[model samples]
Target: MILAETLLFALALIDCGAILFLLIYYIITLSDLECDYLNAQECCEKLNYWLLPKYIAHSFITFLLLFHGQILLFMLNLPMFIWTTFEYFTVPRGNLGAYDPTEINNRGQLKKHLRDVMIYIGYYLIFFFIYLYSFILALLKGDPIRRGSDDDIVTEI
Candidate 1:
């Protein structure tokens, strides 16, 4: 139980870190796009670099949670995992995969992407809090196994 808790805590920590980094990157990209500092193709290309790793990490976390019988926790993140996985497969890879580069303007697409990122950022923040609470509760509860004591002594014939 302790092992499982520890592993879950570690994985959640890593996931939270990834979520933070992603949130920052997304925000920067959105700002740059809005300010005309970064072109649509460049934004997509930069974000492309993060897509696969985020998907892989999310999948691993979901798998680990399922393996450990964390059904509730697993369910909470299932939709996000499924959505990301689906996107990973359906979306084109590399430059301009997320948007049509030939389009005269990508402002609308960038706005939509920003909204999606904000939603994910909120979801991940909530999930991180839940994971932190679970870890703390597990620590407080402690192990079920009692420490060694002089209770029943073995007798030799």
Candidate 2:
């Protein structure tokens, strides 16, 4: 149980780090697109590079929590995972898993995408906090490993 909790914490930590990176990247790219500093297709392509790995990491953590019997955590994360996964699969593909800039006018797509990214960042922040809480609880309650009794301790002399 401790092992599972520890692993879950570690994986969640890594995934959260990736989410932070994506948040930054999205903000910058979206700003650049707004200013006409970057081409829409090129910007989307760069963002697309990270999408698959993000999806994979999210799914792995969700499933790990489920299989480890962390029911509450699993339940909390399941809805978002399912919603994002469905969005990922259902979106039109020619744009490379990103919103097609031409589909919306007045920079609406960019603004909407940025808003969505922020929401996901917020969700991840809460999710990470929950994982951290569980990990700390496990550590506090876990028993220390004992290799041998006190009699087996070797004296410095």
Candidate 3:
């Protein structure tokens, strides 16, 4: 069905946009942590190794779709990308000290720590769901998320 195909195509575009948005944000956030907080440049290398390729792939898919005249879907990504970029520039960085007795003793500091951790987790989840839902929608639309996923489709349903 054309509707299903459109949904599949849209999911792919959103997945691409989501990753691009989060990849930029995460890289900046982690880099800030490594540079200004941790002072350990090597700390985020593994994450970069794992994510850089995916980011590239997402970019490629989004751009290709855009070039092919998917204007609305591509346009939808602009606000997210802009917001993420804005957040990267505006968010503050702090020292990454571990296990300070004063921090635990102060309830306010504890709350702040909790809030920051929750926010970081939230950022991860936001894009994670985009990736997840894209795959799910793809499968539901009878499209393959990957090469091996094709065989799992049931047409009679």
Best by lDDT: 1
**TM-score-better candidate, 2 vs 3:** 2
| True lDDT of residue 61, candidate 2 | 81
Candidate 1 per-residue lDDT, tens place, 62-120, comes to 88888888899989989999898787778555435544454415447667777888888
Task: Report the C-alpha displacement of residue 101, candidate 3, in angstroms.
Answer: 25
Best model per TM-score = 1
Full ranking by TM-score: 1, 2, 3
Displacement of the residue 30 alpha carbon in candidate 1, Å:
1.9
Model with the higher lDDT, candidate 1 or 2: 1
lDDT of 2 by residue, 14-96 (tens): 77677767768877887888788998777777777777777888888888777878888889889888977886788785554
Error of 2 at 124 (Å): 0.8
| 40-124: candidate 3 lDDT, tens digit per residue | 3333343334344543554555565466565675565555445434533443444222323323334664345345445644644
Per-candidate TM-score against the hidden true structure: 0.80, 0.79, 0.33
Model 3 off-target regions past 4 Å?
1-42, 78-157
Model 3 quality (TM-score):
0.33
Please give the distance, in angstroms, between residue 112's alpha carbon in candidate 3 and its true position after superposition: 14
Task: For candidate 3, give the lDDT of residue 71.
Answer: 68
In candidate 2, stretches whose alpha carbon ends up further than 4 angstroms from where it belongs are: 1-3, 93-95, 104-107, 143-157
